[model samples]
Target: MPVPSAPGGAAGPATPPAPHITRRGLALAGLATAQFMVVLDSSIVNVALPSIRRGLDLTPAQLSWVVDGYLVAFAGLLLLGGRLADVFGRRAVLLGGLTAFAAASALCALAPNGPVLVGARIAQGAAGAVMAPAALSIVMTLFPDGPDRARALGVWGGVSGAGGIAGVLLGGVLSQTLGWPWIFVINVPVALAVGAVVLVSVRPFPAAGGSFDIAGAVTVTLAMAGLALGVVMGSDAGWTAPVTPAALVLGLAALAAFVALERRAARPLVPLRVLARPRLAVANTIMLLLGATAAGLFYFLPQYQQNVLGMSPLTTSLTQLPIALTITAGGLLAPRVAAVLGVRLALTTALAWLAVGLAWLARADPHARFLDGLLGPFLLIGAGLGTAFVYVTTLAVAGSAPGETGLVSGLVNTARQMGGAVGLAALVALATATGTPAGTGTPAGHQPNLTAAFLGAAALAATALLLSLTSALHHPAPTAASPLLPGQRTST
Candidate 1:
């Protein structure tokens, strides 16, 4: 089969290429698998946290590190990874990242101590940063048409949305039946298999030549790590702690330095011009808020199930099916909704749904029933999240130059990860500060803290809604001539 030419005839192949299982379809598959793995890792360890804590003899802070390590590395390195993919070949970087991720997963499964486990988690996250951008770039390159790309993205979004819920369910089942290690162990074979598929199916695209921005990379990485660590530690140590204040200060300083460096660097990690676009900037802000709100809700929901509802880990995981299934359903339906309602209308509606869902969750009590109180809210949350993801993602990627697609995608995803880390930390801090005892393994008192967390999440969702509304009103719809990276290319 002949390879399809890239946009503007800057490629090595001809048009009307013979379809061998359609390049678009295969590209979508590869991207979806990457997204699934990344999303799955996010919460897969939650159900096994107790087992891990017991087996590793971890303190609460150490246990938190198991999750935090991954977020820090993944979020910190994402921009660099995306630039690397653009400089090198996306396929090469993707396969390498997959191999590294598989090895790291194996190491995690074999870890004998908390430190080792945390280190392995960090390696896995770094590999994820590399893999994610390459995967999205493959999709962007393969599906150049608007309609085709939209459809492919809907499937991609569905996989990502479903993967989060599936992680909890799979983790619960694996931990109960096999052991916590299996949760990590399972990634090895899956990663290897996906690596093989990516190697075989993805065609080589031309590399965009550029030197890595080492200074920008270092500063941004430190900034992200500092910010994430500050929030995570603040939850346990109190916001007034010297360590928390120091971390926040250091993070802010580093970020400011990064901005200054980018303004001067010949090849910046993230071009400052890209950030100048109102639509992209606003969209990313909304993405960050939505991410934080979603993570906060997912993190605490299991606590309510296990502590308040008296559910087993397995049952708690099962109860999240309403969220998983609805997210998948909504993701699959998002493109159609976007087509019918337009991006602005769809986005506004989704945000409204999220607000309502969060408010409903805030009303939960110790006596709340699953069907009446939890199920509907979960379903609504999932649906709203699913729809919002499509719009936000589309806006993030829509008008970028070909060379900058990976960077744009990586930045958007990085925002999501950072948001999740900060959001989770903030909610936990609120629970701790309000002196609302998060039930010492009891039923009655646990619900109030969780409810408070959900209320905080609602406020975050409202913030996102406000931003989305402003973006819709002020920014015009992006056209094909617009650069994918913000301000990187001007309208023709």
Candidate 2:
């Protein structure tokens, strides 16, 4: 523990009181909880889709929107949210976002129609966009770079990784036992509780100095929203669908415009120069790949368990518990691994581990029991996800200026979100095209080839692994404030 400095060369205090230590712990818990809630909502409704459809009398298209709407809005507005936190102060933005998120959850629970539910979900996403980055920024503030930060991030990454699977499990129990509405209702209490904890425990961070870049924010949000919409529509309606092409075009144009605008803007939302830094750029790229694999795996695995392996929904949820737990365990291991290997090699090893897991999963026997085929691969994948999540995040935030931590946080979050949305769409398309045998039908009435999706996901991880290796050749491992075991060298 660090001691407080005394004035005028006097000796420093020996140690802080217990309450101070407790408050710091409370702040981290509060922030990690907030992050968990946001991540949980991303996939919580997946298991409840059928219940939601019956309750709202939704069309298939509208049902899809219930999930996609949240993703689109969340991915779209994250950068703006991070910029807002930098300009408006972390605590204020975090508190405001929590309030809005809670309100949105209530609206979702009380929604009477499909449109209302979809709109409410979008509101939830918008609130979450702001909530997540601010919460992470506060976490960065709480722990300075070193072992403390790595350990805290291990907790953060573990919770985050677990939330995706936990959503599936919790959604099933709540939807069956209580109702579909309970899933949304659950978040309200959790968000409010987190808000209260944050209010008491976290000290407010001063706002960053700069004028808000309205034009840059608008263009980037449009770019992201359009891209997300295009992918979702393409997945649903086919790539040739009119709206799909149109949305893609608009997204590309907006992205181009945003880049140009950022270069010229006096107060850009994201500084291009900062983004151009090799370590940050490499980290985000690898994160995008990892995110793609994680999202695609989570989306497809449940379906495979049900449609292929013949597991009940509840059973499938139970079986997935190991994956979530191992991911948390892997996160806990990341700091130690980085200590030995350095950040670059640690990330490369994690990607390679993920690729091996995904490849193993691709060949899983449909007729085999979970323990025989699925469990081994799941453990490997979960561990890889946990470790990579920490290492890549460490790379992204390592050398950022104090005032720009929020922006760096936003960029990393945006990369992962965008990757999840786009990669899932692509993987779905691949599975659809290749998973089915010609002129043959399966018992599940044409379930897409899930193994094919796993293979594609493995390919993505391999690509990331190769990229990390290539990057190692060109750039020495980043040494800025990154955690290393005592006496360990920064480079391999």
Which candidate ranks first by TM-score, i.e. highest?
Answer: 1
lDDT of 1: 0.72
Residue 187 displacement in candidate 1 (angstroms)? 0.4
Model 2 spans > 4 angstroms off: 1-32, 46-67, 110-116, 138-168, 196-210, 397-409, 433-446, 472-477, 480-491
Cα lDDT, all candidates: 0.72, 0.73
lDDT string for model 1 (454-476, tens) is: 88999998898888777443355
Candidate 1 regions exceeding 4 Å error are 1-32, 50-61, 139-158, 198-209, 396-407, 435-448, 471-473, 480-492
Give the range where candidate 1 is weakest over 10 consecutive residues by summed lDDT. 1-10
TM-score of each: 0.83, 0.81
